[model samples]
Target: MKHRKLISLAIVPILVATFIATTATLSLAGSSINPRLYGSDRYETSTAIANQFSNQTVSNVVLASGNDFPDALSASVLAHELSAPILLVDRNTQTSKAALDYIQAHLRPQGTVYITGGTSVIGSNFESLLSNQGHQIKRLGGSDLYDTNELIVNELNSTSDTVYIASGQNFPDALAISSFASQTNSPILLTQTNGLPKGAQEYLTNNEPKNIYIAGGTAVVSGSVENEIKSISPNSKITRFAGQTRFDTASLAYSQLAANPKTIYIASGLNYPDALSGTILAALNGDPILLIDPSTPLVPDSIAMYLAQLYKNGATPNVTALGGSVVVPDEVINNVVNLLNGQSQSPLFNITTVDSRLNFGGLPVNLLPNKTIGSTLTLTNTTIPIAVFIRR
Candidate 1:
């Protein structure tokens, strides 16, 4: 028989277990992986996003209606071309006042402020407010959203042979391709579901771009429109980025257009304000803006899987959410965190025991149950001399 001494190691197990639980909690709730950029309202949120561009020299500012999305959908490329920030404003004097203040403070002296819509969307009073500040104001509004889009493209003065065509009826498809458009200095023209907008038709016929990328499926932009595009620009190579849903379309666009983004900005696909302003930031960083459905708690399966694969491939890009909790809730971020942690398809809470080996004075000891000691002992490498057990 071997003589053995009973050592009381009750405290070690409790401490180690507590540390593991706390660490797991922190890892799940940590904001380091996904930071949010939002405000109390859409107007203020655009301002909050604009603040991110403060470090850079922003000589031009693109102003669009916060209440509407059409005119602003195609402004990202123009904003990127001018090295400016896209700020959304409302007709409400109070809301527009804040944007004006931001412009006055941030805009370089004699900086040009480009307004996207006509007086109907963004009233002339707001234009007057911007002009009163001594900043040169250029209003790009046309007869309709399509014309406005064409005017914006013309302002780009881009000689690039690539052009993107997305639906004018909806906001998602255009925004899906906005960042890529900004990157290539390509113009994004809007067309009706069944026909091409006159302005877009004329522009395509005149410029005759070498490449035309159409966003969304036939449901939003029917085959008729594609045929019309072919008639107008026969030589242009047309590629369509469409999916069963808007989220899928956005994912497809990101995967095809942006090769390897250093950062990914996740925005609400149901709404347009956050993404409208965020596009400039994405373009400036040469990153991709991925749209997420806010109504669902979990991220779309396709996006979650793609992100998990990106992580597994050793690409750890910084992820940022674009709106407040109401727009993009914590549950969505939690799901994103799981994907980034390489646990997208795994169980939610994975509770497992740590190693049972104990390091005591440079010696490995296994915890054995003895009649004298009623408790089991397990250990990890810690300052404590005794063994410990950690279940996380």
Candidate 2:
């Protein structure tokens, strides 16, 4: 009976499963894929993002003006809520064929394609173009950016005791924090550098949040602007995370908001599109993003210090580099990897030899059920004895 027990046993199944897994693990660190997302241009990059994050079937898609960034910055919340992807379209050019192709191929949208801006930015004929392709259109816009932002906030149908305020004049700071705000259900209201715009003020008056967060320095959004906000909501606790530069501001903002996330997305500081599309994915994954200088090939010293600190505090150094090598250079990638691997430990523990697997896979044959023969096995921090049943 003992010899007969060996006949039905086969370690080959276990060996084959482990071998395949070990091969795949060779290119990975820990369980995270550490994906580098990029494309030839912004339009394609947005599509690539959808491909990675959205399932093959989706009902809605958010379309924003590719000619500018303000509209898209406020659109992330809607996208996140609808489980949709945001695709940018050139204002005069209408919807880019790549975006339409992505929708046709991946999304299979039987519902609405929400447009962020009105006719002036995306053209009046745009809605018809999408309708021709069989998508119902819902337009969200107003006379200007602030009005549009207010409308977006109203669309959310939800608010928090906290609100994030950023300048509508520029895109960097707002783009940097959009993901965080969306994830937390905090609407990002835009204001001019000198004063709070009427629509934005109305938004504050309507919501009456308890905590107001300013996302940029005085230069981008002045003290006068901050005071205007405080006047509207005098009882609210106001906090500012500003810095000498946009990069520093982003770092400070991330430090304040992200409580030790598993992944960090690195996007270009100089441009907006990559970060714009990347934010939705970042929010979905519960990751925070840091902006980098696109012109330089080396990692900035401040960013390196920040990453090193995160590692020291037991945060996994899994990073996703957005944009192409032209935008995020190869040297920066090497520096990031080196910094994460600096603790004299490999990010991935690979089972390189059969001897290692034999020692680890020493389990009783009875534990593995029938037909699980070629299944992968994972043992973590456990002392249970695993046998390798070999049939000779």
Candidate 3:
């Protein structure tokens, strides 16, 4: 339940949406969806957030992006918004400049910068960026010097009093960490358990622990997990961060974080297709309840809320890109073809693709929408039209 007085929406998320299969002829050409034109009301940095939004306590903030770097401003703003420690996921030299730039822009000279991640892969100077930003930075383990497994184990082992959990995207490494934590018998516990699990679903009811851990705000702690929170942990703290990658990976991360009285789940991969959504991030109020970039906000609008509402209402978004292969599936192709099967000809269906992705430079096929075959028309050899990234 969010603020009903301030934010109003037909609020929905398209994560589990079942895209309708349409034939080219049946698609009903010229149909369009109402696109929302909105952005942030104000610009902000990562000053103090996540906490205000979380129903729990979180220790660190994790930055997970599939590409080069999360928008420096966005990450920096988020760190400031959460006011928790920060973790940069793209730990590599390729990311050095972006990381450094992030620090220079966000960190104050007196701040302490902590160097973590594979050292050899990401330069030692990475930590310096934070240190120079006025924050005190302490260098943690490095990947360049050791294996992430070893580093993760060593770090958790060294800090026996604290427990660390991995959340977000279904990364193999993140999943392994969850299994390892459950197997370990140390007092320093890294938690791993989903509220949505068949077993835990029953346990969480009135099982009333002081807190609950969420893997990522967007992934695991959603769907049935939402129901669990509604039934059990409504008052339970939601310690979530941006870290995990896929839906399952995030579930594991939230699993680990839930171990504590106050859990902190992290989102892993920010770049995965459909990994996020615009409508999902907008309801970005913290447990503390603050919306800095209310309009052009970063994270998807209340991913959890949207998921819950969409599921409840039986509505979803028009997202076809996440399943992979932007080439337009043969099913869709057939739909278009079949639609035109009965008719002699069908109007050309327009395709809008970004420029960089189109490779028409060396296309050998003809660049036409549908072809003319006898009395019936057909569409084939799309090497040209698929070259959306290429210019004519």
Compute the lDDT for candidate 1.
0.75
Most TM-score-accurate candidate: 1
Score each candidate by Cα lDDT.
0.75, 0.71, 0.29
Give each model a TM-score.
0.78, 0.77, 0.33
Ranking by lDDT: 1, 2, 3
The C-alpha local distance difference test score for the whole of candidate 2 amounts to 0.71
Off by over 4 Å in 1: 1-34, 55-57, 345-392
Which ranges of candidate 2 are over 4 A from the true structure? 1-33, 92-95, 343-392
| Candidate 3, position 239, lDDT | 49
Question: lDDT: which is higher, 1 or 2?
Answer: 1
Per-residue lDDT, model 1, residue 21, is 15
Residue 76 in candidate 1, Cα distance off native in Å? 1.0
Candidate 1 lDDT by residue in tens digits, 1-392: 53323233434342222222112331432225547888888877788888876645568999988987899898899988887888898865565765777887888777898999988888888767667777788999998888898888888879989999999999998988888889778889998999998889889989999999999999999999999999999999999988999988887877777656777788898889998898888886567777887655578876776677766666666777788866775556666767767775322211111123234456654433321221345545634433233333
Worst 10-residue stretch by lDDT in candidate 1?
346-355
By TM-score, highest first, what's the ranking? 1, 2, 3
